[model samples]
Target: MEKFVRVKGVAAPLPLANVDTDMIIPARYMKALTRTGLGRHLFQELRFDDADRERASFVLNRPACRDARILVADRNFGCGSSREHAVWALTDFGIRCVIAPSFGDIFSGNARKNGLLLIRLSETLCDHLRREIALAQHAAIEVDLAAQRIRLASGETIAFDVDTDDRHILMEGLDDITRTLRHADAIARFEAAIESLMTIP
Candidate 1:
């Protein structure tokens, strides 16, 4: 897991609302059984036409929005089936952080577990940021997990709310497994004691 302290990169605007997991990566592509390669199918439906031709109008397909690390989206982002692949696709595509007014509960959990920062901010503020990025190519957006704030190059900051424990996880690049490993010595000692007790009369 990579520590998400302060990420400054291209801010892609995904202005649509109710962007569910299936839309992020179609369920058909979910058969891969591995995290790698999903980036190629991220937003498969929107990125291409029915005939499999590229759609130039989609936000992510735009030349300037490619390789965007931060996504400014509308309400209810990540809304459908809780596919972990959705998180994989976004992260694989270089999107380290996502800013939206609301997010699906399951998808949000999966994202945090995978080391992606999901930010919740006012819808108005999110819109402002989205538009700002579209107006400028690779417009820089800074997300500081320790500070719980997202700032644009212009110096405007939007404070977001995140649980203390989750915030700590992002700052230290700790997933659930990593968090448990933090107490490895204690766990080993307890196991050793249990083994000795079982062997005694």
Candidate 2:
């Protein structure tokens, strides 16, 4: 997992709502447990046609959005199945932050654990950002996690709320395992104390 203190980069607009995990990476590409190489399969169905050729109509296929690191999507983004692969695919595609009106519960957890910042804002704000990205070629969005705000190209700033623990996890680049390891000494002491108590009894 990578630290996500701040991100200022091209934002791709995904206007469709109810985007599920399957649509993100598709179930066929979920064979790999590792997070690497999923970028190629991200949005496989939308990015490529049945013939496996790039679809020109897709937003991600557009030249301006090719290297987009921020994704501004519609409501109910990352809905459906609880597969963690969805988060893996997005991060692997170089997307560091996802801005939407709402997200699936499981998907949200997966994203946070993997160091992907998921910002929930009002529907109106989401629409504004999406439209802004579509109209401006090579437009960029700045997300400052420490500040809990998004800076748009029009010089407007929108505030968003994130769980405090999630914010800390992303800022510090700590995954679940790493987070647990942070208390290694305390855990070891507790285990040793319990063992000693049992032996005395």
Candidate 3:
């Protein structure tokens, strides 16, 4: 997983609440075995129409937000299902972070494991951010994980909070395997002791 130290890019405004996993990436697109290539199908239903044409009304399809790396969303984002694919789709689509009032329990876990930063803020603060981003000349903002703050293009700053463990995981880019490997020496010592005891018999 890539380390998420800081991200600066257009912050897309997704004001809708209760965006589910199926909406992020429909199950039809989950047939593939690998995580790659799912980016194209991210927000499949909302981004494309019944005929598979791009929806002009979708925020992601708009020119300013087409390459957005950060998303400012409403409450209860990622509310349905426990699919990790939703997190995959977002990361694959180049979204490194999502700012919402709250997230689904399962979806939050998937996001952390997958290296996507989810920031929880008050509804009023998120609304303020969305408004600022929309009015900015380029709709770009910067999020610094080290400092736990957001800097808008207008030179204003806002503080945010993240769990210490979550921050460490992202900053160190430590996946589960990598994290486990950090205890390699201890694990090896324990195994060696067990082997010695078995040989004593």
Candidate 4:
């Protein structure tokens, strides 16, 4: 997982609500356990038609949004399923942060673990950001995790809340395994102590 201290890049507006995990990356693409190469299939159904050809009308297919790194979405984003692939697909697609009014509980956890910042703001704020992105071509947005604020192109900054521990994890680029390894010495000591106790019994 890559550290996510701050991200400044183009933002793509996805105003639709109730976006589920499957929509982020369809289940058919879940055959691979590795996170790499999923970017090609991110939003596969929406980005491509039945013939698997790129749909020029899709927001991601649009020239301005093709390389967007920040996604501004409506409420209930990532609503269905608990697959971690959703976060993997987004990260692989170069999306570092997602701003939405709400998100699924499991998907939120998955995102944090994968070093993806999921920022929740008021519905009104989300709408404003989305509209701002739509009005401009390749509008740039800044997400500063340390400051917990989003700097918009209009010179307006919006504050957001994130758990302190999750913030630390992302800043330090520590995944669950890395986090556990930080306490390896203590874990080893405890295991040794347990072995000694077992021998006495």
Candidate 5:
């Protein structure tokens, strides 16, 4: 997992609501059995045509939105099935942060574990930021995890909310395995104590 203390880069606008996990990385692409290569299939249905051509009209396909590291999306952005691959695809595609009004509970947990920062703000604010990024030539924004605010190219800042534990996990780049390993000494001691008690009995 990558530490996400701060990210400053191009911001892409996804205006559609209820952008589900399947939409993020369709089920057809899940056969790879590895987290790698999923980015190419992200939004496969919407990003490609019948002949497997890139759709020019999609927001992510636009020239300015290419290589965007921050995504400002509409409400209920990560809704639907609980595929952790969605977060993997986003991170593999270089998306360090996502801003939306809400997210699916499972998706939120997956994202936090994978080191992708998800910011929750009001729908109105998300829409405003999405529109601004869409219209701007640079479409660049800054997300500071320590400050819990997003800074637009125009110098305007908007506050967002994230769970304190999630924020700590992301900032410290603590994946599930790493988090567990941090308590290795304590776990070893507990196991030894249990073994001694069993032997005495």
Candidate 6:
């Protein structure tokens, strides 16, 4: 997983509230385990029409938002199922940070595990950011993880809170597997000790 230290990129406004995991990445797309290809199918239903065609009206479908790295959304985002694919899709689609008033509990955990920054702020703050993004598609937003500050393209800055351990993981690019592998030598030593103890004298 890529480390998220300080991200400065274009912000996309997803005004709708309560976007679920299924909506982010449909279950049909779960056939593939790799997170790479899911970016193409992110927001499958909303981004594309019933004919599987791109919906020009969709924020992601819009040219300005197609390459957005920071997603500014409304309240209760990422609700419903606890599929990790939802976070995968977002990160795969080049969205490193998501700012919303609230997020589904399970989805929040998934986001951190998948190296995505899920920012929870007040509803008023979210609305302010959403409006700011809508005003300018090319606006650049700066997400400083180290400082725990969100600086908008409009020159506004806001503070946010993140769990200390999660913040460390993001900063060090350490995932569960990566952390376990870091102690490979210790694990090997433990196995050797167990083998010696089991062998008859």
RMSD of each: 1.6, 1.3, 1.1, 1.1, 1.1, 1.5
| RMSD, candidate 1, Å | 1.6
Q: Per-residue lDDT of 1-201 in model 3, one digit per residue for the tens? A: 899999999999999999988988898889888899999999998999999999999999998888989999999999887788899999999999999999999999889899999999999999999989878945679999999999999999999999999999999899899999999999999999999999995
TM-score of candidate 3 relative to the true fold: 0.97
TM-scores for all predictions: 0.92, 0.95, 0.97, 0.96, 0.96, 0.93
Local accuracy of candidate 4 as per-residue lDDT tens digits, 1-201: 799999999999888999999999999999997999999999999999999999998898998888889999999999999899999999999999999999999999999999999999989998888887767655798999999989888878888999999999999999999999999999999999999999994
In lDDT terms, which candidate is top?
A: 3
Residue 181: error of model 6 in Å?
A: 1.7
Candidate 1, TM-score vs. the true structure? 0.92
Local accuracy of candidate 5 as per-residue lDDT tens digits, 1-201: 889999999998887899999999988888888888888988889999989999999978998877989888888888999999999999888899888888888999899899999888888898888777766775678999999988998889988777889988999999999999999999999999999999994
Residue pairs in clash, model 3 = none
Evaluated at residue 69, the lDDT of candidate 6 is 96
- TM-score, model 5 to reference: 0.96
Task: State the lDDT of candidate 1 residue by residue for 62-157, as single tens digits.
Answer: 888787898889999999897999999999888999989999999999988999999898899887887776666567878888788788877778
Evaluate residue 40 in candidate 3 and report its C-alpha lDDT on the 0 to 100 scale.
99
In angstroms, the error of model 5 at 82 is 1.3
lDDT at position 195, candidate 2: 95
Cα deviation of 69, candidate 6, in Å: 0.4
